[model samples]
Target: MSRTKTRFAFVCQSCGFRSPKWLGRCPGCEEWNTFAEESERVISGGSSARPAVPYPEIEDLSLSRIDSGIGELNRVLGGGIVPGSIILLGGEPGIGKSTLVLQAAEELSRQGLQVLYLAGEESAQQIKIRGDRLGLAGKHLFLASETCLERFLEEAQKIRPNLLVIDSIQTVYTESLDSIAGSISQVRECAARLLRFAKGERVPAFLVGHITKDGALAGPKALEHIVDTVLYFEGERHQNHKIVRAVKNRFGPANELGIFEMTGQGLKEVDSPSQLFLTERAPQAPGSAVVGAIEGSRPMLVEVQALVSQSNYITARRESNGFDRNRLSLLLAMLERRAGLHLLGTDVYVNVAGGLALSEPAVDLAVVAAVVSSFRNQPLSAKTVLFGEVGLAGEIRAVSLAVTRIREALAMGFKSVVLPANNLPLAEGVPKVELVGMSSVLDFMEWAG
Candidate 1:
């Protein structure tokens, strides 16, 4: 008789980094105490080889997508859900990941499509209650409350549904692996199996994934790579607005965003996100500036607010919300060096009106204007909008879609715009909006004063 062998390894909970011995910190994500030990059974068996087949000639098969009856969702999914594509949807707990999936499934079922919902985290009764509350009474929509991957796959094959949705991937477990559900091994193995199933059956699948404390997908990082598309549901749980953006999409463009407002019935699509973001604006408020920003091809007018005051401590504190802190520091330094705002002893704080995060450099000029307006206690015109990229050398740089931004601001009843000089030619065709082109940060400060 031969003794069976076992192999032991450590896996990082943060990034799935594997190591033979435990280390004080994970080299992958530089986190401490995140490693978990796991054992692998070494089986004694002869490996079977697969038979080879002749390669068939490639043919042109254009993409075929299914609409979920939700226009905003279809936009984020690049028109619609692609056949056989596995989509991983992740977000903070209670951030509406489950709600959005349920809504989409219900809509698809209404369109005469058979939808199979595999609920691992919730019971069938709970799901039915939610569906009832959402007014979902589709006979074609089927539900199965199970955590075993094998059982779910069997039921899926038996039903042969047009679409499949796993309420969550983190809760599912497979009997073949000894690891518990949500473990690194279990997550990776289950995701791979589901991807294979979706591809073999040519059915689009949506998997809800749990998020970690740091707001990343709570599992092996490889789980994100195995899926065809990755979508992130973001927004404050207490807030009414929720944003869905595609971080990775093999079939369509990345960074595409879809906006929604949470309501009693379910998630409602926001037709005009820009207007919703600026609905509570105060008139003629000092330190408030409107920025014409383009988020995923949609032009938006978002309010940027700044506060500048004497620092109580020796070192001035620079804080930001919905904006980058380090970028704020650089912009402040530029303000002192070039614009001569004398902000060295001032504590600066910047915030976007809504919970929307602004990353595009086009809003740089707006931040500067807001800070200056706050420090001087002067209010910018309520009808004026500003957008331009500010450089370290204090020069203003042109941004893309200048005409689109101007038109969106003008349509929103804004009359004036401060833009980069180089982008003036692009917006010259627009007559209703007054475009003021500035070459440098100093020029903008002088004009505002």
Candidate 2:
């Protein structure tokens, strides 16, 4: 009698690690009490395994990149899509990640390039319907609805398209990886295989990935490390505009951004986001002030609105989504202690108009102005624009790239600006905006008063 070969199955619930049966901890990596018993499909007996072949490196001079026909996207991709690159796109659900690539494929295909779009999440009919609605006219664009990795690879080899898109890498699976779809091991294995295929075949692949609840790409930490580029699709759901930011890149500037507005047809480029952010401005409105901030290389003027009201609640609740709340409290304290504004009986509320989460300290001046404007029942002058950093000691501080902010304000037709006293290095030969420099937060309060 011959000894029999056996297969075992196990799963790690904590990290979702699955493997062949019972171990003290997990041989995958030494994590105690992480493994659990799981029922998984096992393969054995009559099977031929092909030896793995290493992908030979292509001569860099021989390979080339093709433009995606979108100027901003080209900038984000470092002047277009490299022939053997693997790019991962991550975003919130229903944020139009799929629609963007679909439109890109349609545009590229119409330009006489062969393209293949593989969607494991959507059916071929569904994609075709969206394409028809988008009014794309091209015989070269192809679509396949498949999720199996082996079949997908085979299909790609047959099609040999100029550009290949997997609607999402999260949906793909490989025979060697026992982990379920979307699991860490599964995503990692699938991505590695796809990367090898893309490199060896000289095919550029675009992967739309699912974002975690924390807004990061969902998968093992290694998954992100495997890709050549990572882009974040960010924006407020209520707003029509979406900002595509490159978080990591090998070929492009890291902070590059592409702005698009979701429309009935598809996403259209927003040439002037400053105009978009301020087009709905309410002139002479108390508690509303314009703030200029830079996102990537683009300068935007967003309005900061605040309302100060009498409140009997002891907590005096401070809340802000796009703007920092702790900073708001410090500003209020400065107003009360140094600037002599009465806030003991008031509730203060602030909002960064357009729902943009502004992180830079540059919004400080506008925030202070909005609060002061509301407290005094006076409207901020429409001709005024502001930027600066506020300090704990009620002192106004210098901010980064001051001249650029002022230049953007002048381009937007704003006549005056209130900024840090120290940040004025004037732009030469340009019609300039009047720069009002202040030394302290108290100075702004006095000015507003």
lDDT of each: 0.86, 0.78
Least well predicted 10-residue stretch by lDDT in candidate 1: 53-62
* Candidate 1 displacement at residue 425 in angstroms: 1.0
- Residue 154, model 2: Cα distance from true site in angstroms: 2.2
TM accuracy, model 2: 0.82
TM-score of each: 0.93, 0.82
In the range 1-449, model 2's lDDT, one tens digit per residue, is 23334344575533445677666676655567766554334434554566765677526622377778877687677778888788888877888888888887877887898888888879888888887888787478888787888888898899898888987877888765566676565676678888989887888888888775453334533456789888878656657888788778776677677888889998888888788878888969999999989877668888889999888798776667578899888888978998788887899999987667677888988998998999899998898999988887878888887778888899999998899888765533346667778889877876766
Stretches of candidate 1 off by over 4 Å are: 1-6, 41-62, 220-222
* Model 2 bad stretches (over 4 Å): 1-63, 212-217, 220-222, 311-313, 326-347, 427-432
Q: How far in Å is the alpha carbon of 131 misplaced in model 2?
A: 0.2
- Give the total clashing residue pairs for model 2: 2
Taking the tens digit of each residue's C-alpha lDDT, what string does model 1 give over 32-121? 888888665544555456566556753212257898888888888887898888999888788888889899998888888999998888
